[model samples]
Target: MQLTNLNMPVASLLACGNDPGVMTTEQAHAAMQLHLDCTVDRCLVRRRARTTLVEAGKCVLDDQAERL
Candidate 1:
């Protein structure tokens, strides 16, 4: 059994970008709702942004330990 149903109209609207000619305000809203309903995926690893900050602190601490 398929767990998800596809909305062709919404899919068409979403593909149209923000063009007011092809997609209207209501259609944009429907597209937004469809986007929000999609599942988000995350990997089990340290994010690069946070890792850089953490590694910077580690390096500073290592330098201080070497000095002492």
Candidate 2:
């Protein structure tokens, strides 16, 4: 997936800076570690927001079906 397309929390975790067009393998690992290490309550809001963003993206894609 494109780093630039990532939502705010995920992009921040990758630490690829403001305009992250690409990410290194180490950055990917660190981001995953951070995600795995965080406690559920601490990450709950972020997780919820990410879920909402994903659902919204799906809706956008589903719009094409409605158009047809």
lDDT of 2 by residue, 1-68 (tens): 54444444464563322332333444443343445655324554334333343454522325543342
Clashing pairs in 2: none
**Model 2, residue 58: what's the lDDT?**
29
Per model, how many backbone clashes are there? Answer: 0, 0
**In candidate 2, which residue ranges exceed 4 Å CA deviation?**
1-11, 14-21, 37-68
Which digits, one per residue and each the tens of the lDDT, describe model 1 over residues 1-68?
11123323333433323222333333333443444543212211112212333344532335543343
Q: Provide the global lDDT of candidate 2 against the true structure.
A: 0.41
Task: Tell me the deviation in Å of residue 52 in model 2.
Answer: 23
- lDDT of candidates 1 onward, in order: 0.32, 0.41
**Cα distance off (Å), candidate 2, residue 46:** 12
Deviation in angstroms for 43 in model 1? 20
